[model samples]
Each structure stands twice: as structure tokens, then as C-alpha cells.
Target chain A: MTEPALGGGGLVDRHVAFVAALRGAGLPVSMAESLDATQAMAAVDLRSREQLRAAYAAAVVKRAAHRATFDRLFDLWWPPAIGDGEPIHDEGSPDAESLEEVEPADLDAIRKMLRDALRDVLLTGDDEALRRLARQAVSGLGRADNQPGRQSWFTYRVLRALSPETLMASLLEAVLAGEERGGLAEKVARQMLTERIRQFEEAVEAEVRRRLAEDRGVEAISKTAVKPLIEQVDFLRASRDEIAELRRKVYPLARRLATRLTAKRRLGRSGRLDVRRTVRASLSSGGVPLTTIHKPHKPHKPELVVLCDVSGSVAAFAHFTVLLAFALREQFAKVRVFAFVDTCDEVTSFFDHGDDVVDALARMSREADVVWFDGHSDYGHSFEVFNQKWSDAVTPKTSLLILGDARNNYRAQSVPALRSIARHARHAFWLNPEPKQYWGSGDSAATAYGDVIPMIECRNAGQLQEFVEAILPI
Target chain B: MPLFTSPDDVRTRLAATGYLADDAIATTVFLADALGKPLLVEGPAGTGKTELAKAVATAADAGLVRLQCYEGLDEARALYEWNYRKQLLRIQAAGDGQKWEETHDDIFSEEFLLPRPLLTAIRQSEPTVLLVDETDKADVEVEGLLLEVLSDFQVTVPELGTIVAIRKPFVVLTSNATRELSEALKRRCLFLHVDYPDAEREKAIVLSRVPEVPAALAEQLVRTVRTLRALELKKAPSIAESIDWARTLVALGLDTLDETVVAQTLGVVLKHASDHTRAAKELGLN
Candidate 1:
């Protein structure tokens, strides 16, 4: 492909294409914004790539969540190919000599070599020596000529070369042979050797993966490198790492919402002329108009009661939703959070004294009076308990938020309990992390609960944010 | 006269006013001034959204008209309101001498009108900077009011007729991205998102704002702040707060940002107690 020209006209065309690419990536960019970006580009110094990228980002990208996608697309569009030449040099052939050195004829010789390399290092706990041996084993055993998709093959070979299993066998053999005979030294040495062997295997595997990544072209690696952006990640299917990332993003999201809410609250007073006061003051000036008075508009701070299902299936969603609600506690006059699995319990006090939502959730799961360690999720029972014990918590002024999958495990779903709560609350909403397709599937009472409370599909952070902004008192 | 001739000019002028403008910010500000379009700046708090408007006002030697937006913000507060007491006085004064038509005309004249920030900015004949701080905080209805002033730089009073701008003011609207602003409002303005500065730029900011801060200490402070930001804290220290931290360190006679000093003075950078405990734990202070 021909490189786009770097002049004004060329840059504008490149920008248009770049915007198209952004749009293809699911980022919203209007034609007007594209034109504004073209105008913004003129004021930016084309010589500096960082400046150009920032200018485009500022002019085009709207939401923070889209930034990662924007950056990736920017790099692809503007390759930055000048000074940064291709650095990956293909090692055409694996060194035969090093391969032969590691390929011993007998398992005995392999065992001897492993023992020699690790014995002293394990006894003395020398991390540097252990690392060097790991690198040597990885290079010696990991053949570079393996097929493109055989990365696991290299990792397996490197692990076998380190021979953690063999090392464990030898250590066991030594201990059984009574080398240190019932002494604490023997026990400690055995423990140290076991830990060191595991580390050695892990290091060798990591080295192999690093080399494999290098073997692939930059484009291939980058394609896999771009994570499912947080906004798009399905909360129901998110991994532990993705969930952690989502948790980190929650605070900033809540803070932005809070700032907007606070600004709204501060501006809550209407500027309608207080005619009564204005007229009363005019009387002092002999009924002549002098100063106009404005009535201060007092914003109603909604009382929030969040009912979250903290069961195994929907705990991740509950964790994030609860964290966001607590973070925005200032926007409401009162906020009460309840977590339930089979039994319902008020967990608002856990967050009352601390800002660590995760820590508080952990404490609630372990020590809260309402939680039972049993894994079953009974929405009917939980709602019944809530109605019997905490019915007074929901008032006509309260905005009741229920965060759960509404899975009743094919048990009784007391829709009346939910209806009563909804009747007492000003507004009630159920945010289900499950997609709409799965809403009424096996064990899901979402359809039944839907009749009493409106259920919003909140399968991701983006949807959750939209729900919050929509429901938040203006 | 245009406030900025080019992007570089924007940077230099803004830097002269003690506010460091990044390339994106400089370019956006320059284009906004050149095109006479309102600039919509959205970012996290303490990233210098409001400061940019102040810098532009200083650089152009223009009068700064600020309207702090919030929910329930009405046109009367943002635009103009007739001085009721003054109008009443005029009506009482003209009661016997003039007809109802003449008195009604007199009450709605310029003398009886109290101009708010939007109207004041439009009325200024000289160079002026109009800052609508935290526009996202205002109700959605406020965006409708702003659309008229921003699009045509004019306001219409029922009795007085449409009053167009004598000299269009440099308009800057800031938001914390609290809520998605109306699409129509976003379309009328040039958008800019001013995120936290990078390490090198942050160091420059600290040095410029708090000159008394030693260079080495400032670097350490900025590094710590960056590290703190990486943690999942409720509120990360903004650049302004980072500068304040550097100043705090200088004033306390602490030449270094060792663990103890940081542990003690982290409050300057981190506002929440939970944040303090978390940072202290992360830094191995406890």
C-alpha cells in the first residue's frame, strides 16, 4: 500500500480514513466532528506524532472508555514507521550445538545435569543462579522452528527440560534415603527444592512464550494484545482479571456521575423571579421596581435502597453495582445497601466507615448476620426476609434498585414481596447482568419479577452507566 | 483581533500566563478562537479544564465572565433578568406623567435590565472570555439556553428584541463528563478532553507553579502521584493537587519524598482517608 502524503490535503484525507476506521471499531464519530477534527489538525504540529494523536483524540473521541480503541486504531492508521524500524529479526535456524548439548542420551544423564544445576542453587537459595539456569534451559530446549501455532509445545519442552517432576522425584528419593535423617534441615531443604523447581518451570515457560510472540509479526501480536475494551466486556462472562479491571474503572465512573449530579444539585434552584419577595421589597421603594429576587430551588435528594444478589453466579455484577452506588452516596440523602443469596441482610454499615468496597464486601460475605455459606440462591426467600425485616427501609421517596440475575433456582418466587417493596418505593428497577436472551431461561425468575419491577439489561459497564445516568434524579 | 495566531502561539501565550497547555489543548484553543466557536472541554477534576479558560482570558487581556452551572440553572440566572425593583420605581415615577405604553417601554429598557454572565459577555465591546464552568452539572434545559447564545452569540428579551453580540466573546464550556451532554450542544462546539498530564509535562507544571519546590523533590512527588493514580483510589490527585503537594513538601522543609515524609503528607495529594490508608499500605508505610 502506498504511504499517504504528509501535506495538508493528504493529512485531511488520512484523517477522514482514520475517522472511518474509528467508526468501524464501534466508536461514534459524526461527519461534523470529522470536519472539526480536520480543522483542529491544522493547528497541530504534524512533525510530532504525540501532538497529532492528542489533537485527534480531543477532537474526535467523546467517551473515556473509547480511548483504548482510539489509540489502537491511531497506531494502525499512523504506523509510526519512520525511526522505529522493524526490530524482530528471524533467527533462521536454531543452534544445533546448543541443542545437542541439552539432548543427553540417557534419562540418568538428564537427571544428573538437573541435579547439578539446581542442587547448590536450591540449598543456598540463590535466585540469580536459578534464573540463569532457567534462561539456559529455555534456549537450549525450546526449538524455534516449531510450527506457528505450537507455542504450547515449546512451553512443554522447556518445562520438561527443567524436569520439575524429576527434581521432585530425586528430592523424594534423597529424603527417603535418610540423607538428613528426621532433621528440620532435611524438611526445609525439601521445601526449598520443591519451590525452586516450580519457579524454574514457570520461568522457562515464560521465556518460551516471549520468544514465540517475537516470532509472530507485530500485526499478529497486536491483534491479540488489544483486550476486549472494558465497556464492551460482557460482565457475565468476564474473567477474574477483566473483573478486576472493571472494578478499577468503577470509581472514576461514579465520580464523574457524582460531579455531574452535584453540579446539578448546586444548580437545582430555579431562577424564577420570587414575585412575592420582589413585590414585598418594591413596597419599601414605594412600589417602584428596583431589585428582582429569585427563589432558591431546593433539589430533592432521593433516598436509595439497593438490593443486590451476592450469590456465586451474579456476585461480580453485584460487587460493581454496589461499589458504584456507594461511591455516589453523596448524591442521595440516604443510601441503604442490602446483599442477599438465600437470606437478605443490610450491608450498608460495612461501607459506612470505609471506602474499600471490596474489603467491605468480603467482610459482609464472611461475617454478615444475613448470609448463609450455602450456595443456593432463593430470590423468594430473600425478598420475604427483606419484606418481613426491612420493609420500613423502603419509603415512597426511595428509589429501590435491585441488582441480580433474578435466578430463583426453580424455587418459589414470591412476586408479591417484590410488589410490596415496589409499591412502597417511588421507583424500582432491576438491573440484570444476564443478556435479554437468557432472561427467562432455566431457573431465571426475571420474567416473573419483570411484572412487578422494570428489569434493565446491564451486561456491561457502558449499559450500567447509561442506567445510572437515566435513573439519577435530575 | 484573534486571540491566537496559531497553536504554537496558544501554547506560548498560555504558558506566559502560568498555565501549561498541551499540544491538543493548544490546538483546540487556537481553533476555537480562530473559528469563533465555543469549545467544550471535558475531563476529570483538577486536569485544568477551568484553568484553560482563565489562561485564555489572561493571554488575551480580556474581561472574564464566569457562569458556574448546576442543576436548575435558568435563563434568568445565565442570561438576563429585568431589575424588578428598578422597573417598579420607574413605573411609579411615570404613573401620573405618562401613559401605560410609555411606562411599559421605560421599564423594559437597558437601564432596568440586569445582565448575567451570558448577556454580559455578549454585551462587552472589548475582548472577553466567557467560562461556563461545569456545564454538565446544569439541567438539560440549560443546554437549550446555551445553544442560542453559543450558535448566534445573541440573546432575545421579549420586550427589548434580539440583542446580538457587539464583539463575540471567547466561549469555553467545561464538563466532568458526568452525564452525556445533549448531542445538539456537543455539535455546536469544538470538543476537547484534558486528561491528567504525563510525567514530563507534570514536572514542568510543578516547577512553574511552585518554583520553590526543588527539582529532585518535584520529580519524586510526581512519580508518587502517578503511582497513586494507578491504584484504584476514589479520587486521584489532579495536577493542581500534585503542585500543591510539591509546595507542601517545600514548605515543610522536606528535601526528599522518602516513605515517612510521603506517608505523613499524602493528605495534600489524596483527599479521602481511605485513599490515604490504601496509598500508605501500597507504599509499605504501615
Candidate 2:
């Protein structure tokens, strides 16, 4: 495809350049967004500030988390006009601030001022002074204005001016480089960065604590057990020990359940005498009939293979279900575990005997992109990956347990993969973490998969355990 | 880096990023700090509650330790679990009665205590921000466990006794309010309910977050998301959703929040096929 000409009845190439620069300078701009920004620029006149503002807004950002970063990048991308960009008002300004104020720079003073300024702006909605202060603070970095590489220098200065983390990182790098100047520069820088980082962290922690403190309505998990006389289902809180005991008790029951479920036997008419069956058969046998005893049949436990999604939205549920599957490996002759976000990995090797399930999960999470967004959920790619690498593991005696939110993000659903796996497996069970009512909405392909096999709603541990009890056997 | 003089200064920051909320954001920020507790923000599905946690993390320059809570979360799952290998080795090496105290202590030691999100937050010496996310979906017992931890910053094990947090861990808990948390836990900390911001606030939020986003387009995007949120969607668009949606549109080279662009990028905000179908039908994208 031919490239669209710059400034030819479209957004100027400079605008795209500005976006690229913004992204390279640490702004999180996607390619799709760059295109949006370009188109937006074309729709609005650059000279008109209002129009320019509207176009930019339309092209980028959707959430509150990105506001400050976007604002900083925006200023850097489109520096204020000369008329609007009055020189820094502080004594620290490039042209006016004394070398003393700029030279023996108090990192703490700068940080405190920045924090107070930020909090003030957030509280009052006026940032003229803060902006001026930011500009002035940049001068203290000793960046020469009007140089060819001045943009990066300016960007760094601004980044340092705004973010205490950036400032601390830069200060540490400077100290490591052995910049011994201004007598106590090194000490001051270290102290300032440390204090600022601390304060910044406290600010964050405080916010979290506030949320945890709030009146979040809670509910009890219902139980099916009851006191002696009558059986009843009631809501109650189960202690950790209670849950553990349940796990221990249920495992044996699961084996018994397996035996009952597959309790079918055939006996031969000749062999060692069968006390019950042979005697009963002899009653129906001919006058001089001899009966043969046959070997009793026992149900073989089905092997299990679980494919779980650990993407940004579904990792929490996946963690629980995956751990449960790992714990129950003893019941089945062979059990395999796999985790996926946009792709799949068989992480069963991590869970050997005596392994801490939590540690194994944590290790896997650290190495894996549990929260990384692959732009889209490509079900096709995940299935293809599994088919190419792990399909052989599944057999006619194996049960496949698939768990996720199943929002495919409009990518290829790869229905054929599920079908193929289902065909080979003894039984296929799709467990959805979300409320059943939310099924069939948005980009979810659950219903599509539901067409192939029974998809059950498994929301809590009780339900999960019951499902396992019902299906984990032959 | 950008500078804001006050919380009000965040208005422009929010506007620049196409965010819509302007009302009581400072109140939310203040309660979080003044209470010396993490803020448990409850909101609708598509509002910016999660983004708020992320924003606070960014603004404060703290390490964001997030624990995405869900069903079947247990003590070992949420707080800590023993590292069996390490425990076994210690047990094997000791193999004697005189080392009883040492062996007992070894199991309860921080080394053996596999720090989940809960323990990790409490153990962090540095200024740490912990996000116990989506508390609604977690079982009531899990919430109770969270309450116990949040109230005292300690975990009690019969073998180890109670391990208290040496450093005060900043906690931020968010919920879609899918289910309510118990009153016992709520009474111990501060509460903030975040809702979708108004048009003006959203405009400001968007501008602040995505400065390169064209002003017209940003405003239009904010308006579009706001409109979508108002609609009867199975999954409403949150601030995070809007941000992703806008970013996706931008990446696709769309200048305006038109129906075509919305259709292509709908997956970001709406996860269900039916939700998309319903939204498209209602919004006239079809």
C-alpha cells in the first residue's frame, strides 16, 4: 500500500512525527492511536487551539491513569506558544535564576515544592505557577536552550521536574557517575531523592488504605450441610482449616465415586467358582452346568488436561482453578496443567512433589505476562500453539477442563481447535468464572464454544469442588 | 513531567486525557491520605475505579503491588503458603530433638512464608502501595481475611503467632460493587465511591492523559464513552475501557469517534459478543 502523503489533504507528516517523538520520549502511544491523531489533526485546524485540543483528545487516551503522563507528553510534544510560554518567573529560570539557587540546588526543597504544587493544583485546578515552576526547575539541570539536541535535554529536565521517581533515578545515575561538585551535591541529591520517593510512596499507600477502609458490603458463602435432624443449605463462613479438611475428606470420596460411576462387570461361565455370581448363575444354568469365574472390572480414573487463561482480566480465577487442578493430580494417573494469556504454556513441570503451589504460581507469574496485553486475545493463535505443541498429550481417556472469561476480543475464535480436542477427550468441561447472566454479551465466544460442549458456571470454591467431584473420575 | 498546583489542577490533567469526572476527585484523594489507609473505591463496571488505583500509584511514585482477588482465594492463596522444599530441607538437616525451636521457627520464618499479595505488602520496608483488586468477586471468607489483615496489618498463625507489618503498607482496594463487603471490615478503614465523571471532567481527564490526542477528537471520544456508559450495556465502558478504546481507534488511524471506528474498536470496551451487538444496535453502529 502506498503511504499517505504528508500535508496532502491529510494530517501533516510533522504531526505523526510529533506523536512518534512523544511515544519515543516515554508516552504510551499505540500505532492505531497515531493514525487516529493524524486523522484528527486533519479534521481540525492546527492554528485553532480549541480545534487542536479537541483533535488531540479524540485521538488519544481513555482512562484516568494516563492523564498526568499524557499531559506531560502533550506539553513536550506541542510546547506552548512563545506568547503563552512566558519565561520562568522563578529565580531558578535559565536566564535569571542565580547560579547559587541553581548550583546548590536543594533536592528536598524542590521536591516539597513540587508535591505541594501538585496537591495544590489537584485541589484548586490552577496550575499557572506550577507550570512556571516546572519551567524554572528545568533550568537548574544546566540544559542549554536552543541546542540541536535541546529537545531531549528539555524533555529530561521536564521529566525530572515532574516525577520524583525520575528525579531520584537521574540523581542516582549522577552520583554513580561521580559528579562531585557543589561540596554536598551528592549527599543532598541522595537525601532528596530518598525522601521524595518515600513521600510519593506514602501518598500511594494512603490512597489504598482509604479504599480498604470503606464500607464494602460482604456476603457469606452458602453451605449444603445441616444439623442432625434435617438437611438444609445455609450461608456460612468456612474457616481455612475447615476448607482444608474438606479437601482431605473429599479426595477419598472422589475415588469411591469413580468406582460407583463405572461399576459394570461381566463374568465367564468357567473358572474358579464365584460364590455369589456363580451360584446365582448355576441356578439358571443347565442340569450339570459348570460356571467359570470372571475377573471383576474396576473403573479407571480419567486423566485430566486443563487449559487456563491468565490474562489481565482473568488471572485471578485462573490462579485458583489451576492450583486446585494441580493439587488433585494424585486422583488421576496423569494430570497436565497449562496457563495462557494470549498464548499457552504447559507449566506442569513447576509443580513437582512437595512444591509450594503459591511459589510455583508466583514464579510462573514473574516470568509470564500475566497482565500484559497482547493488543487482542487471539484464540486461534492459542489453539494453534496448543495443537502444534501439546495436542499429543490428550487421549481418549483424558478429560479437558478449560477455564477463562472467554472474551476473545473479536480475534479468530478457532472453534475447530476446541472441537478437535473435544473429539479426542473423554469429556470436555468449560468453566466460566463470570456470572452466567453475563454470557453471550460483547466479544465473548463462550456461546460459540457452548454449542460444542456443555459450559457450566463455576463461580466459587463450593461449586468448583462439586464440579470436580462430579467430573474428575471415569 | 507536568505540574499541578492543586487537586483542581487535576481537572485540566483529566480533561487533557479525555476523562469525564471532575466532581469530588480531591475528596477521594484526600480521604485516601488523611485516613492513613488505602482507599477502597467501588464503582460500576466501566467507571475508572481501577484506573484510579493506577493513577494514585503514578502520582505518588510508589510501587504498585496488586492482588487481583477472585473466587477460591485461601490463606495460602491470598496471604502466604509454605515453601515445602525449603521446609523439607530444613527438617532433614535438623533431624534432631534439640533443634526443635529452630525447626519450628524455620517454618514460620519469612523465608518459608511465601509472600502472597497480602504478606508482600505488609513486609515491604519501602513505601509500598498494595492494590487488593476486585474484592467483590472474592468469597466472603476471603474478604474477612482481608479485613483481618487490613485492620491490624498482621497475620496470625497458630505455629508462628501473629506476624505484624514492620512497615506500614499503603493499601488501595477496588471493587465493581458486584457484591457488598461486610460491615466489620468497612468500619476499620476509609471509603470512597467513584462514579463516572461528567462531560467536562472526562474531557479534562482525556486531555491530561493523552496530550497528543486531538482536542476535538478527545472531547468527542469522552462524549462517546459517556454516552455508552449511559446505555444499558451488559458491560459498561470504564475509564480504562475508554482509554483503551480511544488508543485503539487512534492506532487504527481514525480521526473521529465515528460509528465505523467504534465498531472496529468496540472489543476493547465491551468483552461480550452480545454486548457489542446490543451496543451497536442501540448506538446505530449496525
TM-score, each model?
0.71, 0.37
Write one digit per residue (lDDT tens) for candidate 2, span B1-286.
1123334444445444443434355433433453345556766665677766666556555667889987656788888877766776778777666467767877768777677888888877766678888886676678778887887888886666788888766677877654446655554444555666655566666666666678878766775676565444445677767667667766777776656677777788887665677567666675
- What lDDT tens digits, residue by residue, belong to model 1 across residues A1-474? 234222224555666767876776777898888887777677666766676787677667776667877776666566443211221231222322333455544545544565576665654546656655555555555564555755432768666555566556566556446553433233334444565666676556545444444454323434443456787788889999788888888777887787666666555666679999999988877777577888766667899999999888888888888888887887799999998888998989888876675678788888776555466888899999999999999999999999999988888899998899899999999999998998899999999999899999999998998899888987
Q: What is the lDDT of residue A6 in candidate 1?
A: 24
lDDT of 2 by residue, A60-105 (tens): 5432233434444444334332211343333244423332353344
Clashing residue pair totals per candidate (backbone < 3 A): 15, 116
Residue B111 shift from truth in candidate 2, angstroms: 3.7
| Native contacts recovered by model 1 | 0.37
TM-score of chain A of 2: 0.41
- CA lDDT, every prediction? 0.77, 0.58
What local lDDT score does residue B147 receive in model 2, on the 0 to 100 scale? Answer: 80
